[model samples]
Every structure is written in C-alpha cells, then in structure tokens.
Target: MELIQEVMIMYCTRNVTEDLVWVGGNDRRLSLFEGVYKVPYGVSYNSYLLLDEKTVLLDTVDKAVGGIFFENIEHTLNGRPLDYLIVNHMEPDHCAMIEDLTRRHPETVIVTNAKVAGMIKQFFNFDIDSKLKLVSEGDELSTGKHNLTFIMAPMVHWPEVMVTYDKTDRIPFSADAFGCFGAINGALFADEVDFYRDYFDEARRYYTNIVGKYGAQVQALLKKASAVEISMICPLHGFVWRRDFADYIAAYDKWSRYEPEKQGVVIAYGSIYGNTENAAEILACRLNELGIRTKMFDVSVVPASEIVAATFEYSHVVFASATYNGGIFVKMEDLLHDLAAHNFQNRTVALIENGTWAAMTAKQTAELLGKCKNLNILEQKVTIKSSVKQAQNEDIDALAKTIAGTF
Candidate 1:
C-alpha cells in the first residue's frame, strides 16, 4: 500500500489596509541575498493583494517563497477571480513567478509599462499582447474605491522600476525605495518593531550595497514623489511603513543626496601582520578618549559590505594599511574600489600607512580616494614602520586630534 505524508507550510503574511492584504512570504532559508550580501536574519519578499471591486496583486515574491506566496493568495482570494496583476520592478526576485501567476490566474490582465512589457516577453514565453495593459507615468487604474497613479522610478535601482500611489488611501507602493534587508519576522509594520535598534544596520547595508551607485537617480525619484502626499509607504522588501515613517522618508532623502547620518569615525585597516591593526587601535583609542564616536574594523576580518555600510552612515573615515608589493594591501585595495564603485563620497577621511621598506599606501589611497566626489582628506597622516612605536604615538595622537577637530 502507498502512504501519503502530510505537507507542512512555512509562511507568515499580513494585512496592510482595510481592503488591502500583504500576501508576501519570507525566506529564512536563504543565507546569501543576491549571492553576495550575507543575510543573517534572512530576507523578506513582499507582495500585496487588493480586495477591491476587482482583485489585484501588486507584485510577486521570489521563487524561493513562491509556494507559500501562492497558497496565501489562494486563501485570500477564496475563489475570487484575479482581475489585474500589476508589475512594478521587473527584477527576477519580483518577477520570478510572473509566468506561474498568469498560469494560475488565466483571466488576469497584466498591467505594466511598455518597457516592462518587453521585459515580460523576454522573461517568459507566453502571448503577452493578449493580456497586456500598458501604462505610463501619471497613468491611473481605478479598482473600486481606490485610484492608483503610476510614477516612473528609472534606475532608483532599475530602469524599469516604478512606484504606485494609492490616492484613495494616501499610500505609495514604493518599488525598492525605502527598502531594507531582513525578514519582517512576525511583524508587518515598522511601528511594530524597534526598527532603529533591531533592523537599522541591515537596512543601511542593503541600501549601500545594492542601491548606493544610483544616488542621482534616487534624488530625481524623490523629487517626483514629493509632489504627492505619501501617508504610508509599501516597499517591495522588508517592513511596511504606516506610522512614524517620516524619519524613514527623511533617511531616503539624505541617503540619496550622499549625506552621512551621524558624526562618527569608521576606521577600516588592512594588515598582513598585527602592526597596522595595532596602529589603527591606537588611533581609535585616542578618538574615543577625545569623546568622539568610533567604529573599527579589520578589512581582512570584516566583509567589505559591512564596512561600506558603516562608512555610509558615519561622517568620517580612516584607512590604515601595510604596503603590499609597493601597493595597497589586496583586501584594502578591493574594499576601496568597492566603495568607489558604489559612488561613495562626501565625507572627511584620514589615512595611516605602515611598511618596513616601502611605505606608499597612504599616497596611493589618497590618490584613489581623491578621484571621488567632494571628499575632505586631512593633511595629517600617521606613518608607522614596523609597529606602533612610542615615538609614532604622537603621530597617532595628532591624526586622532585632527579627525576630532573636524567634528
């Protein structure tokens, strides 16, 4: 005789508004997000279901959570025919289940822009023209009492990205904007958790690593969004913002302009031996003793993403490295390039170099950092030979004093 084993479900979803429900799901099983950033608390893929006069889904979750997502949708619908499937950002994580959703809801009309329509055709092999309903910026779709206005968000992280404004509810379904990295846990809203204490770091990391390069684009999107009165924000990831969310919007505005959140020093050091790190430690100690906030990391130990995230939040930065073959150390070099590639700029910087023979790291680092935008590199640099010598302690002190003086 054949035996059947009962299937277990692993999913958590919530409701956003009176008629709108959050039918998204989480992926605690995903260790790495985008196969690069480390997601310790995992990540959440958000999608919304609108129980209007006509049923609609804002977006779809990642394929990893598609099963639970579909089940949630099925339960929420309760046999109501899905009328519209709105496509915002066409990233694979958001669009992975596009074909699957269409197959399940055959009567559903796919609503998107012309560029996204092409992308849909590129991503799936279906007769899209028959089900496609193309829209543009300022276009509105009325579903019962709700009127959603589309706002184009080009390269806020993607060219095809767009946000929807629910004028009826004063909610903006922001696509990838104001998004963070972490599963929503059991809570669905930002006010439900101590966001700053528990999730702020991950949010910074997510913004810096993924969307850091396109600050200009983000600024444009923000300017456009300012014209609309946003009461609540529904991003495609992490927590929803319904209450006490002004600070969150302010954060996006500041970050998009490449402004630091607070006045603190982030010291990232690269050392083959312990000498360079020792020098870095001495400087950090002096800064702390001077009543300045400081965060220190070894480039070899901490991943570049974390360091970059910290640097993005702080007003000042310090780089210490031991010369490697007459150049900056490999890890340190990679980290600097990573920061530069992400358009990291607009902060005060100091440097420290250590070498037995050729001490050229500080100059090289300064030159590389100089190529970026509006960075204030200090004239004072600390130089160490083998270790933190008693005489070089004065140099460390001087650098620390200079860094503190800026604040």
Candidate 2:
C-alpha cells in the first residue's frame, strides 16, 4: 500500500518486505529548531507491531501523542488484541504510553529486563504485579513463528536498556541504536532518506549530545551487535533501517571510538571582545596556509553542546579566550566544566589567552584541561598583551605546528 505524508499523525502499516507494522509516531515538533537545545530535524517516537501466531509491540511514544499511538495500535490489531509490548528503553519519550497501553490491553504482558522493570515501577509508580516477563542477556522468548532474543545494553545511554532481535525476520529492535532526531513523513527504511548527507549528521549529533558520555558502553554494545545476524534495525527514533544497515552500525562504531571526521583543527574562541576572536581567525588562517583544515567557533555564538560535539569529532581543539576579572569568561568556564564532566576523550588541546593585567585565562584554561580524561595538552601557551602584536605571529605558527603534529 502507498504511504501518505501528513503532519502530527500516528498511523500503522506493514513493512512491504517484512511482517512488522510501523506504528506509534512520525510527528514533527515545530519548536525543535528554535535554539541550541532544539534538534532541528525533530525526532520520531517509533513503535512496532510484529504479528505471527503471537503479537508483539516494540515500544511507544510520549504521552502527549498517546492517543495517536493507540489509534495506530487499534488500526493494526484489528481487534485481534496485542499479546506483548516490548519496553526497549525506559526513557519517558518511548515509555510514557506504557501505562495507558497496559490499561487498554489488560491481558497484554510487558516484556523487559530486571533493570527495566525497576525503572517502570520507579517512573510509573505502579505495582505491575504478575504482568511482567523478565528476560536477561542472551535470553530468547518464542511466540510460535518468531523468536525474540534480548541483548542487555547497559549504558548505551541508560542502564535498563536492552535490544530485541527477531531472528526469523533478521531485524534488531534497536531501542536507541542507529537512531536520529528527525520525523519522517512517509519514509520507512533509512535508505529512502538522504542518509549519507543528512541523516548521518543528525545521528552523530544525537550520539554526541545524548550518548557521548557513555562511549565505552556503546563500544561494548556495538561489539555485541556485530556478533548478531541483523538485516534490519528498528530503532525508537527516526527511520527504520533495512538496507544499508551496516553503514549505520559502522557509523556508530566510528562515533563510539571518538574518531575524527577529517584532518581538521577546531579553533574555538571565547572572546570577551573582538581581541580573542582576532587571534582565532589569524590562527585559523595560518593553519589553512599550512594545508591543515580548520574550523572556528565563537564559544559565545556556537553552543557549548555543539562545541563539545565538534571537539569529539576533531583531532585537535584549540581554545582562545579573553581573561575577564582575572578569569576566563563564565561561558568558557561552563563549557570547560561540562567537557570535564563528560571526560572529554581522544583529543589534543591547545590554549590561547588574552588579558590586560591579570592574564588569568592561559593558566585557568590550562587548569581546566586537567579535568578531562585522556586529553593531551600541547605544551606551548599563547599569551596576548591585551591585544595582538606582530610577535604574536609566531604563536599562530606554533599553534599550526601543534595541530599538524598531533593530527
């Protein structure tokens, strides 16, 4: 059947090549691109209906869209009644409709792991008494024609998270794996979208912003996923992956490893005035002249989240800032504080500071570097005399050398 492109509606239809029904959401939030926190492409709250002899519903969307989600559920079930609802991730965005679902289909069993059950109780405050079926790692539950193998993915962003694999369908119900933040109108498979150019960036942005802190755990999950025979990935967000599934896995693999996108130097400056920005631009030019690709961000203009995300994607990060009241700008401090908390890994950092009398940024910025894990700090520091000088040309040259050598 043909799919329609309408906004803010949840509907259901069977995958042309698979037995699973796409239900739940493909709604877009208009406010999703208003600012730094807004993920421009929005997101999809995906759920699935897999029918054999027994039926399984993968996940649900937010309570705000619970009505539409249930509408999709009703349309797909056609009064046969759902047998199971698989709670992949316990995050409210995907699990908010669980309560309503349970109330609607009182006989439907909730399938999840021990940790997830705890979260369900904690989040919903319901004594689900006897309605829970707990599965652990490598555990398989059979429903006649199809078998679901549960793989525990702790800290693939959350502790209670697990992925469901239907071996018969060769599909992995990847709770949050291979997910992006866009709402698809009519598309089902990822290959239907321009994933190479657009979706990949959204996926990376999602990973860096949400799951970057759990890089090690993601790597472990990726390893586990690699061992499975998966032809499709039905994540809780964005498009479903049927064809080119390996590419998404490979993309996640690279992201978890903190691999650089390209040989580029990111010159991030926290400028109090135009002074520090001037230094950054000059340094970028020098790096460019030396055949080194450079991307510059004014920490004031670009968000701290974006900076951290880009920093993880670059081999070299150079921070330029003006000292204010004997310290680096509050914004810069906040950025450094966040970077430290996330254990900013796998990058070389260089510092540039400008201050009239106190000149505290160089030392303070360098001190902030100590908070990050696996961070390599270049030995040379660029100190400005409240302004740029001809002698400062050597500092840019030195910065270029540091980046070239590290990359």
Candidate 3:
C-alpha cells in the first residue's frame, strides 16, 4: 500500500494583540458593496479572535467568505473551543456566519444586547432564549484577563449597533463606526498604510453614502466615545487603528457635524449635450484662475457616492445641469436627491441651468436645495439658453467671484 500525503492550507490571519487575532478575509472579487456602491479595491470583513482563559470571538465575516473565515478562526484557535461570540453589530455582513459558528461551536454563548438578540432570531430563525448572554449600555463581562464593556450606539447607521470596549487592552471594538472600504492586503493597521492617499476617499465615500443620514445619531455616539479612553480602534471593516487615534476621531467628529474638512469647490454637472458641461467647465476655469481649489465631475458619469463624498469634503458646491422635460436633468436630480437624503448642509451653492426651450433647471435645483439645512444658495442664478456665449461670461464671472469671495 502506497501512503498518500495530504497538504492543508491555512487562511490568512493577523495578530491584533498578544492574544487577539484577526480571523477575517477580504472580498477582492466583489464588484459592489451592499449591492449598491462600486468597490473596485474590494472590501474587508473583519472578525477578531481572542485567546484567553475564556476564548471569545468578535463578530463574523459575511457569508460570501464564510469558508475562509472559519478556516482563519480555526487556525487562530489552534483547536481551542470558542466560549463566547461577541456581536458588536447585527448587519448581515458581520453576522451572516453566526449560525454556522453556533453549529460548529455548540457550547459558545452569544454576548450582545437585547436588540441584537431579537435581530439574530429574526435573521437566522435561531432560538435566542437558550444561549444568549444579554448585555446593556455600560455592562461589563470578564473573560479571564480581559474585561469587555458594551456601549449602545443606536442608529449609528443601525439601531442595534453597539461597540465593545476592552478595558484590559484599552481597545474599542467600534463595529462599523470607523470602517473603510479597501481590503487589508499586507497592512492591517492604519499606521502601516498611507491612509490619506490610499484609503481616505474610500473611507469618506463609505461613511457619506452608508451612514451620512444619521448625523445626529453619530454625534450622540461621538459624545459618548469622547468620554472613553480608547487606545486602539478595531472596526468591523478595513484597517485597525493602533496609532494616531485622535486624527481619525476628529475626522468622524467633523463628518457627523456636517462640517467640511477642507476649503474647496466641487462642481458637478449633468449635461445632455455639451452646453451645460461647457458652462460648468467655464465656471471651473474662472474659479481656478481666481486661486480657488476646484474639482469638476460630470454627474452623468460619476457615481452619486463619490459626489456625496466630494460634497462633504468641500466647503462649496456648484450644480450646473441642462433642463430636460421642463426639469433638472435626471442625473443631476438624482445627485441632488442623494445629497438631501444624506442631510447635506452648511455649504455655499451656485446654480447654472441650460435649456433650448424652457429653462427650469435653476429653479428646480434651488427649490430642491431649499429643503436642506443652512444652505446659502447664491441669488445670481446663471441661465444659459442652448449654450454659453460671450453674453453669459459676465454672469459666470460674477458667480465665480461670489463663490471665490466666500473662500
């Protein structure tokens, strides 16, 4: 008889602490996140494994990467049984593997709040009465050397969302609060990567599109967070934060407050042909000439998520659209509606409309923006009939001057 050799391949895992291991995987093949936003760089589903007197698992990966995630968890455990599964957020991406995990680790007790306990039953049809360890705000649980505290952060994009604080390690398992979109390649911590250059835009896009509407809720959460002493942040997605925690917290504070991060202009245009685009281009040129930092995007081409992120980053916004069917162009209309839905406010806005017949884009745009909060809609509405000729130059220049003057 010939003996056959078997090769066992272990999944990728990273150490977050002496005992805590990152048992998560990246979805590089995914084209979209949440079946909506485009994720070209892919997204990470982060789960943590803590080996202690009582082993605990922090969150779980999405079902798409369930096999690899399990492999990572098993490898990190090294045959040790999981004692507790700490669920920080009940979103499907982070909780989809809960049933599989429970089936495998039959003795594991789920530690979460009442709201999440109900959600688990609703999502997985599992009986939450038997193995659930319910926690509340400021509730503490000890797993040998580590003491974990739960903090309720309702409507931080989800009503059942909560963060876990490790008192022994001074680490906060912040759920999706500080998460970004990009996959963690070799670098697992924020200090390991060029975050501002590589991941900042995606982070902003992620927050603005996913959690922008709940600014007040985020503010409340931030207020609670300020009272805690957080040394490291372990979010459910993207890289972990072991250093420069203040900068990330400040960024979140500004975002939750609807305050622009920088002084600049974002000119987004929806043009049927080239007329409206031409007007936008001309205005962009004027702004640039006047020493104002400007960014231009064709609303028809760019995704609304990116535009929303840009609107959040910049202090000023310019909307130029061609009137279509007696209204603003559909692409621009969609962007405006998204901005409003995200609770966009506290910015200076300039309107430009182009039409061959009835020019209703400017009026419709103004009305839509009027519904938002603290928006300074410029009174100098530039109307372009068919195209921008030399006659519209003075109006364009005036609008540009007004926008530049605000800077």
Write candidate 3's Cα lDDT for 3-64 as tens digits: 99996957898899999999898999999899889999999999999999999999998998
Query: Alpha-carbon error at 87 in model 1, in Å?
Result: 0.8
Winner by TM-score: 3
Residue 364 C-alpha lDDT in model 1: 98
lDDT score, candidate 1? 0.90
Give candidate 2 regions above 4 Å deviation. 1-17, 30-36
lDDT of each: 0.90, 0.80, 0.91
Name the 10 consecutive residues with the lowest summed lDDT in model 2: 30-39
lDDT tens readout by residue for model 1, 1-407: 99999875544568898899998888988878988888889898999999999888998979998998998898889889999999999998899999999899999999999889989988999889999999999999999899988999889798888888899999888888888899898799998999999998888898889898899998898898889887789999999998888787788788878899999999999999799999999989999999998999999979899999998899999999999999999999999999999998999999999999879999999999877899999989988888888889999998888888899
TM-score of 3: 0.98
User: Which of 1 and 2 is ahead in TM-score?
Assistant: 1
lDDT per residue as tens, model 2, 1-407: 99998755446565635567887675566444323455656667888888778988988887756777888888788788789988889998899988888888988999999998998988885557579999899889898889889988998888989999898877888888777877776787777878878777667777777778887899998888778787778888778877766666776787788776766878888887688899899889888888888778887877777777777777888889888877888888888887776657778888898888867887788777876667788888788877899888787788778777776
